[model samples]
Target: MSNSGMAIRPVLWDGDVFRVLDQRLLPHKEHYIDCDTSDKAIRAIKNMAVRGAPAVGLTGAAAVALGAREIDARDVDTFMKKFDRLCDRVKRARPTGYNLEWAVEQMRLVVVENLSIGIDAIVEKLREKSEALINEDIEVNRAIGAWGKDVIPAEGAVLTYCNAGGLATGGYGTALGVIRAAWEEGKKFHVFACETRPYLQGSRLTMFELLKEGIPATLITDNAAGFLMQKKKINVVVVGADRITANGDVANKIGTYSLAVLAKTHNIPFYVAAPRSTIDPMKSRGDQIPIEERPGREITHLGGKAIAPAGTEALYLAFDVTPSRYVSGIITEVGIITRPYTRNIRLALQKEAGK
Candidate 1:
């Protein structure tokens, strides 16, 4: 499939040598950053050249494998030691998205699994698996999109927070995936995208994506959501999750919790679109999921432009959690999981993982 001026290959794609969509110059300036070297890859990730949980995760493996390919050594031990350091460093670029960490862990397992299997074999398997990780996310999103399409009312308004669109995942998306499916299904649903304070992922990215697809949408400030809801405009709330706890708590773009609260006050249904892997069993509750506090500059600026004159301080938080009680359902690739997540989420994962 192809979109506007771009090709829709598998979700996990590679741009020139090492360049990724320069999100900083988006919706106005279309650009990509090149990072052929491991060090350069680290800088790209650190500077937000490439982001979104699934996107970053695929990039993580790509960067690591790219680094491994650059390793120069005759001795396997020496080569492994050197590449390990590079891989570990790249993994540190983003500490919040578990996908980055998850991809790294998968890459490491591939290396171990291929031991005594020869360098060529190891590299081949890693490459295949890395690519598969991306395709896996794509397939999951497609399934999620199909199954999640029904969550939205047949003819009602829906609200989404942040930039969980095709750019956020391998291809289709997460919460936005549902929207895509709805569009495909000929559902005439109105979409309200939050500007996602401090980051503006919604305005800068989500809006861009929806417009690209010719989807009907309206952009609004994060605070103005309640007013729209008060007018009985928003009947359902659908957002993406970076991480979800065993207890059903969700962590996503910072203003998401506020939306959830507002939805509850207005008796609107709040829903979360997330992949199964995001469900962390180790973390028993939302409190355990690591909430990333971005640099203070994010709150004081826009698109690398300083809104507050020079030297003004900024307060930034990359994510926030919404308790399960505020959410009505969690749509996954397998099916939709409704409230009372304490055990149902865990059980759902077990059943799917069993497959």
Candidate 2:
């Protein structure tokens, strides 16, 4: 299945500019923000104009390409020095998502391998590398869907959090990709999207994609998940990860750990769907994965309107970690990784590397 027809594309490279579908206006207005410069692209990633792990990674690669073009260096060594700095900045845009660093590193390798080539050729190679990341992400997502669809029950409800749809990837999604694959294979299932709070990516972006695809879905508040699970309304739980540690621990949207805990309590299967790029082998544990902290205003305000007292203090931790013990399986493009996660996760990644 090709992702050519995916209705929602969160990131686009338009030859001249990196185009990001402004997610903040989603479910209300569809808008695209054009980033012709690296700074603009970095700002888009930082401000959540374009989000999701895979999407941000692809955008970061594009930012490196754009930054490469702006380098005034005529020699390969000088260009690489500037390019390294650019990659560092892009990687720092969002610390939680491994894909950002992974994607930028991929771009960096392209330059390193072609150092003998002229600076102009390296720039062109960076462009090609960014485009390759886009295509590769779509293909990887489709493969993940193929492997993960089997986990979806023939006819049951699947609970998901945040926006892991086409809007979250190059095209097809991670968690939502599994759902989409099952749907395409004629398996009937209802989706319950948790309205991920403070950001509302689930209610806005996820629902928007679900409705566009004509999928049967319901929107639920973040805290209502356990009640629904108790009522047996939820059959399985699946979510996308910003980063997966070597031990198979997952760091995702803020409320994902809660869902995982609830799923475990209810004896429901909890799964994480992501491309291999989202895995950080360097991080041996979840705590080693940096959790991004957003501004308190995100919690105290909604759509630029104040919802709390002027001095109300709020803690907006953008993500939370779910231990491998809570995860039933991890669906990757390579395959579904099951426990003993420490060993299995390594084998899965080695398989992905064609080792």
Best by lDDT: 2
How much lDDT does each candidate structure score? 0.78, 0.91
Q: Write the per-residue lDDT of candidate 2 for residues 102-122, one digit (tens) a residue.
A: 999999999989999899888
Give the residue spans of candidate 1 off by over 4 A. 1-19, 72-84, 353-355
Error of 1 at 275 (Å): 0.9
Weakest lDDT window of 10 consecutive positions for candidate 1: 1-10
Tens-digit lDDT string for candidate 1 (205-294): 889888888888999999999999999999899898878888888888788899999999999989999888777767788888777778
The ten-residue window of minimal lDDT in model 2 covers 1-10
Candidate 1 TM-score to native? 0.91
User: What TM-score, over all chains together, does every model reach?
Assistant: 0.91, 0.97
